[model samples]
Target chain A: MTLEASFGTSKIGADNIGVNCGTMLYNEVKQFRINHSIAEGKIKMENQVTLKLNYPLNEYVAQNELKLQFSEGTTLGDLFLKEGIPSDSVGFAVLNDTMLHLNYRLQNGDFIRVFPLVNGG
Target chain B: MKWYYGKLLRVNLAEKSYTVDEIPEELFTNYLGGRGLGSYLLLEHVQADIDPLSEENKVIFTNGFTTGTSMFGSSRYAVFSKSPQTGLFGEATSGGKVAPALHSTGYDAIILEGASAAPVYLEINDREVIFHSAEHLWGKETYETEDTVLREVNTPKAQAVVIGPAGENLVSFACIENNYWHSAGRSGIGAVLGSKKVKALVFYGESKTSVVNPELLQELMKEMAATGKDHAGVKAYRRLGTTQMVAAMNAAKAFPNRYWRDAYYSHWEKISGETLLENFEVKPTACPKCFISCSKKTTVKTGRHKGLTIEGPEYETIFVFGGLCLIPELDEIIYLNDLCDRLGMDTITAGNLIGLVMEAGQLGRIPVKLEYGDVEGAAQLLRDIADRRGVGQVLARGIKEAAKEWGLEDLAIHVKGMEPAGYDPRPLKGMGLAYATSSRGACHLRASFYKPELSGMIDRKTTQGKAEMLIDWENRLTIFNTGTLCQFFRDLLEWPNVERLVYAITGLEYHKDKLSEIANQIVTNTRIFNAREGATKQEDTLPPRFFKEPVNNGQDRITVEELQFMVDEYYKLRGWDDSGYPVHEEG
Candidate 1:
């Protein structure tokens, strides 16, 4: 299971500082790169999906003991639903402690964390 | 006659006479309500040139049109008069149950004129209004007066507006404390009340308000409450209250330590929201119909200050007492807030005055041994300031005057004789412009930019296009204050929805930006009043410190030249000249 992101590296707008982690929208990642290609030599899933991997799995989710898995071509919303998390309940998502939208699609081997709302003024 | 109670209650304390007069409808519409109404009426009805503390001067307490209703955050009333500090338009507002209680007593406003020979308190319950001798309440703390009035009135729900020993002694920065915690905390309004020999005003009524559209208003109320409760902005306040600001400000290196001499403190984290909640959090206080319970009730848990309990150290208090004074001890900041609250003085100014003393001591302006972060020394100074004793008498005159008397004029950190709030203007340049030209002098509530600037609502570093945005906000804020709606609404509710809400309730035809225009007219009218009273464009300038001293490490460093450029742009956007005077030519 992997999740990859695009444009989350730039702290550009209000949406960039999301409450938690993971890209909320898969389309944002798609737009971040003009062409999409999945990384090779990973767990081969289904035909309709592809995986793009970044960073080693051992270094992911540092300082927290939690198990999270992602599916290729899976939307952030779809991945959360698979984890039994409600769509309306979460305000932001993160791939690596950076904020993203739920509509973001997951690439292979990208560790992600979903977060609730941000209310700090 | 029914709508307005058909009369203004004019109390003349010097001659001990009271009069009632029918105020015109146009005047009411033009000013709207609250601070706008009070300022307009004071500027028009009272002589402008008189001394602020003179017998001829008047103090006007006004409630907005929506007050006493089930409207969310409608429980705000304003006190307007000439300030003994600025000698300009002095206006300050407070929120509690008091506004609704006063509004229920069949009056739009209470105008206190002249001066009393003896201390007195006003009691208005139902259809009756009476003046009682307040000799026993004189020199009493504000919280004690509120307690005594609420008990003696036999109404636990009665709202009491009280002044402390500071006001009784006529401290120029005196504030009026309402419901023990909420305060009309700026512009020296409490001193004005004290000068007239008034100690407190207590009121309670069983009356209900009648609006133009009851059904629509009910729906709007439900919506507004829900919105206020759920808004991220409002929720933040509810979560940490104003103390939430400490983290953000500290991160930005804008924490004005020791009167802007330093930007960081070693124990900054000890006085933050997390720390406050960990150390002292007993309960929460809320305004009328407001679910965002941002106010805190705190009690000391340990040490020499143990057992001391107070309602707050709201952002302004936390900033002035903790950040500005470089005192990172939460208990000490809480103690200072409690002292200022009970004393009926503006905590920001009180803290600023203490900062001046610290800076002066360092510079050898004062022979006494005063040092930054000295909580005990500062506590003693608070006592002296409240009683106007010894050196406290000089401090009681306010920071601007105190600095002059101490020969530390360059160290004074105020614009137009009012202390700057927590944020140093250098980091947020627009606020520098706001402080310089604010009609009521250096005030944060008049316009707060930190909410948008730091919260990613606007680009904090960009000063390119903020002039128009600031002007628009200033005008709109005037509408909210006058309409008696909470400023907290702007984050979630759009202006059109706000207009719809007001129109649905009051049946007023103000549409879209029309409310803003009406607000502009009110602001313009105020400026005109000041103009006639001899205010000049030259006076619309920041304190010398703001332009002269740049914060040592903050990212934003606005020079005097840069500030002038922004103010010039702001003047142009406001239809004013380079000198900050309103342009007379019609568009």
Candidate 2:
């Protein structure tokens, strides 16, 4: 899971894969063109990993997603602490397809989906 | 009983008349309300050996002290009867806007007894019951019937609980529709109503349940509001609804895919909650007097089935149709969900029966041929089941009859003739015990032990101490039902809150031990009823496939040894003998 996404302009959404690169997707991504957003003066971040915050968390981040460049070997807990997210507030997290705990180390170019606790039937 | 009207409305369909009886304070004192109260009333009024669909069978509707109050999840109701589906103790609960209305009709509970000579509906206002001819509405779907009744009653703020064609046909899994979308959705309660020739019941009133300590209630409300505003559960539910389980369960590899042939679906992303929000025009819908709008009113905006809308395809519906039957498209699942709602059928049971048929067709065990993911074919079969045509006729009798008829008894996954919800109990070993010993046929909600297992609250594969935890959760949830509160508020409504709420509402404080005692007693009462109907250890076991098949090609499958360990422990802990019967309890 090394970083492979390019600085392209295609927007990713839903379950659709990002066409700009071969392996990057931020489903529910409104405008996640990393370099393109930076070039357009939308955001200034050096991180390669994207965190798509679902609800309440988005309020804390002031937006739907955050681009954080994590230190090598950084765990999910490290990233959440850096981003000011309370670990207890998080119900569950998914990195791509697998459910990963907070102790799981972050992979480069990872698209993490974090949501609060939902009472499932 | 300052908080309660302490009244029972008994309607005799045979005579088209009603009577309001003074309910004993001692009854409420012992059983609380909702499930406990209703079950006691059921046992007292109806014989255990009577056919569930016969006129002698009684349908009891109940609400708690919190209902019609300022409680957050108060707009929920419970229906208790002998199940036409399982031929055992039957109970179904739902959250909607109906409970408050029904509660306001100035009674703690209502009982419908005897069968009418023709199709009829009842109009219930404050202290009055009006019988009406429902002959014209006998065949209408639940939504249309509700709308017509609401209009015909023409009373301000009136609500109707109605049944559809499936109920009229006495489909064993038919459910009573409420809020036009939500259902007291399991146990064939609608079939009970239909057998009594009752098409619908209307409720309306301004009467309210008095609070024992209004100031204390307000204080608790203030504290709750302050803390719940930022609660993760609230944010999550308001955002994604229960459909989020599709992602969590799928990601954990705990999902049941392709009628248990697989553990996870390849096309899961297409039907996940995120995908549904991403693809469909989903609007969050809430019941009356609630803030967490967890129900998704989704509409197809782009496909050929565009503009089609339904209140949900909840996690259970998605798991059954999308996971089991392999309906890949979310919109198609929504379509089938709408179909079940309109027909007044329980989606879980309907999808399960259809999935069984699909498995049968795939194996060439039946004359009909339908494949997995064949949306049209499944839809046709669903219609057939509701209409009681050919194979549908057999299925309308229930899974027990259908599986026996198709000679696929080994393949059919059920307990006590009722199918399970989304989770595959084989892998979640605790769920195995849950399904086997639920008293109401393979019910998930009795404990919803999947929540603990899937969320890592306990070891998923271990049976050690599982019975202890399962009983804890089940007893607490029984209190939840006795409160008539929605299960979504389980996180927010902690035991302390429950204590205070009960104190404020009933002028009685329910400590954990006291609550557990009441819950255990209530469950044991239901067990006694089941035992009287000939239930035994055999009925309290999982299906054979669970013991043999491993899910997802993994080693997470359950063994009869493991399930028996938990069952024995559960029974022992409940003070029951090795036979799974209560030792010292009275029926």
Candidate 3:
């Protein structure tokens, strides 16, 4: 069953943080969303769910955030593993300002921001 | 046999005499050392019902099993006594050369008992203990006291733990300071030290503990040094130190600024780690035998306080002054940190009390005209607290007393009369349990459960499995305290490394399970000590405001029911009664 979802074009992009750790990857990143292909009816939104990913995770693919798509109900843990990200790499994921667990099931058109795990400080 | 000193030095200040008691291997086998052994000694020596400020309350200094060895993060010692602040079981640990220095004195534990007739200091060189007049050093700041003591002792490479004016004044949150900045900086241990009327204890000796397996310990230390350099936690700390926590906690919407009226500070970046690096002259340094070097020896470069320097305004310090008091300037925060260090007061408690004063000013609860972001005012107030004058006199008694006298008890944020660390328990519910159930009051280091929660090892909101995970984290960290390893090494020393270090260093014939039992017993022992001090389930709770106020747009809050649920589960898991007292088990 396909759940109809309304998606918006996002202006969100990579933040230029002058974090002094010298360990972070600075990527030329931007937010990604579906290209309004639904009006052109060139895409089926049932099986494939398009979502936006952020840097650290995006550093691996070096692609637009919206270009990544997965099947419906994909968990964050599965997405991290599928992207070849180390299990301990990401600190947390935020969807619309709500912090997410790795077990959170991904929804279609969700824009998530993932951060690095910084602790012991 | 090896690595275990199996000796305790007991000093009677009243008689100005000392004696060496032989410890049994069985005691070392049961209680590892440092916090574990210190807890056991506190029970055996100090009576439960004595006034914390009385001479009947004994102060103990202990080194860990691996201390004075080649182990990384081993430069730490634990102080145990009845907390003058909480009037309950008290323990504080510090990292510096003091650990190995005290270890060199040829004793596992040094117990200071009885009050002296006049101010005095002790010089201990191996088995020799000399009593020296400290009437001149009595009023000096911690740094000058150390300089003067080392000058008088005539012992090269000697390190001394000294109490400053706040301690001399019997401020309930006074801390014992060493190396000018490193402090056993909590639990009112300094007051207990002061109550003994002894000014300082210098440790200098050539003795070294022979470990059971030097080659294996050497190999483990090598692996730690090699891997720790590239470790993410190590690198972050090496670069920015704990000051990075300001931004991270603020970003999580749990920075607890303006006396926790607001969880998020708008100008957090102004006083953050990045700002500290950009604005100050910082040189990364470390304790002896440590590679992580998480401490930043910072000096003010361009400010009113220029030329002032200190080891850190650690994360807890920043949170209290920068976050709680709303000091937007990192330089000012560093200055406050230095003030507390010199005064021999705990910055967390001092800043917290000052933050409360600012809140009362704002709330019209008190006549003081202080306000948030008042750096100069906070500095002056710190001096006042040390001298025990006016409002400082009330606050000198600690928040539990000061809050009531000012009719601000309802507004104070504390558990068991102690302030919480940077992580507000509201947003992170596991930290709620961490604070509520910690033997020490609202302590973060006990579990550092915030690490697991913030890192997404567990959902921060859920209380379902939090108790079990919190116990696991607390139990493991109890070993860190027992082993007296730095908490920063949690990433480097896993269960296997802990087992290997314990086996090689102490030869305890232990693994994770056996060591965990020792850790549990230590925790239970502390709980039993608190119980004897009249603490009940009522004390194992957060301030009312935490439960009532929902942070982050009302999205994050821990209800009384939620906290009670976790607390109940924590007590059950620790084998404590419904009243939160652990069942005592004889080793």
Candidate 4:
């Protein structure tokens, strides 16, 4: 789904503060090129993955769900950086409904869910 | 004497008289203040067998020794009474301007006794106490009552704690709202206030507390702020408030859903903190002097509930209303939250009751056709309960009594008459034990064992070592609650800091060990009080659901045999007898 459709772009624009989704897209493009070159010899093909970002965290991505292509060994941490999610903002992550570390390698057809940092009673 | 105001205000509404009594220095040394002192006073004044809604049942509002001082997260006060719902020791703490206002009134505690002949409010301005007729304010919502009280008292800066119509109508889970949003919102403390015919407490004071070591306090406050800002938990709380837990808890399969029938909510993301910030949150708010602003001011900008501004549908509210009731719409959750606040009812109990009613209807146990996901019906029921109308009358009694009356005791999800918070204990063993043994019944805050469990400080799936960990947590929280500090600062405030703060404020030397001893003493005393009220080992238990039902898609389950083992281990750790009574050491 398009970012606008998933996040309701109007509501996002009104609430978006320090987050710049446009810049994040540009950075992701740049990083993808670099990773593609680095993995050219190591891996044969790109891995398609589905990512879901839960709220507050979604503010950074401006989309609830994203389908992206990544290098075979690309870590969730790399995806977070490419998506403009500050390391400090992430509380935990789930991969295919299981808790995973940021270093977890992205697999083809894998689904990852990102949660924002929070604490309460 | 430096930190403490060294006085308590005693008001007998029946006689319409007020008196200022000097606080014994020994009381501070023994009980510290806030929850500890309040518990002591409850045992002393309130009879164990007295009906909680009777005039004989005393309600004590107390600030900690460090409360109103320059200590970080010290802006809290405790409201202790015999719980109209649980019939046990009931205490709820709230943050905002009220504790500081109470502290500035030159009293460490304010004890209200005897029912007023009519609705009345007590106004405390420094040394003076004025009893004002509250006939006009009685049935108003909490926010409106606070505004009216402040206007009538003619003190713009004064803080007021008022109850809404639910309390006046004697809804068993009624809460006392302060500063419009903050509430001592558990254990039916508001009903106790209602029983005494108290409409509001308006406090205004300019009196400043004397600090024994001002320089040390200043240094400590700075250090605390600096450390708190760098703390990970504090940062998370500031950014996402408690809403952060929605995704994480759901992922961990610990978040309660559908009245504990499920551990996961598929629509959790739609009702999470992120969603709230995106759709409704206007700004972040905090209690007085708190570095971490975990509270939110939210407003609906569009749709049917447009322009509805409320302080929060905090983590608990979201869990209860959103997850428990299957209400996926954030606007509906926010509206219901506002309704509960305006009606002056505990959202946890209110939502739990609705969930119970819905479950009962599904089982054909009740004639009502209420169903899960019926947000409008739930909101109507909240209002009805506040007004004590029809089915609402039965529900207004809370889940325990209502379920008992319906003869559906097994379906009521509560411990000691008080409903559990969001966490499903079936997945978290320590929380199960904590809920079962909590003095106030099914409370998470009394000992937030979920933190340790979820954070991997201990095994969440195992009962091994949980009993000892629970004992430690209970003692630690006893100190924190008695210190009257916000639990949000648990990571920042340590034992040494507590001791140093106490020494700096009170000029009384207290080691970490001494504080632990005091905490143990207070906990033991509370147990004794419960024992006197006929609580036994049996009462210290989770409901049948935890034992009989499995959570996490049936991946995890707690057995009755396992819970009994934990209870036995906990009682032994507490030095309680087999019957769960505290063992006294003879000199």
Which residue window of length 10 is worst by lDDT in model 4 chain B?
Answer: B578-587
Task: Give all TM-scores, in the order shown.
Answer: 0.83, 0.90, 0.89, 0.89
Candidate 1 error regions (>4 Å): A5-121, B1-6, B155-157, B206-208, B552-554, B582-587
Candidate that beats the other on DockQ, 2 or 3, i.e. the better one: 2
Candidate 3: residue pairs that collide: A32-A66
Compared with the true structure, model 2 gives a TM-score of 0.90
CA RMSD per model (angstroms): 7.8, 6.5, 5.5, 6.2
Query: What TM-score would you give candidate 4 relative to the actual structure?
Result: 0.89
- Alpha carbon lDDT at B19, candidate 3: 95
lDDT of 1 by residue, A50-87 (tens): 22111111112221223333345668666555433445
Tell me the tens digit of each residue's lDDT in model 4 across B436-523: 9888899999777777776556767788999988877777778888779888877666678777777777777878778878887888
Q: 1 or 2, which is superior by lDDT?
A: 2
Q: Which is the better candidate, 2 or 4, if ranked by DockQ?
A: 2
Judge candidate 2 at residue B229 and give its lDDT. Answer: 84
For candidate 3, report its TM-score. 0.89
Chain A TM-scores, per candidate, are: 0.41, 0.59, 0.51, 0.61
DockQ of 2: 0.33
Q: What lDDT score is found at residue B76 in candidate 1?
A: 79
Lowest lDDT block of 10, candidate 3 chain A? A1-10
Candidates by lDDT, descending order? 2, 3, 4, 1
Per-residue error at B401 for model 3, in Å? 0.8
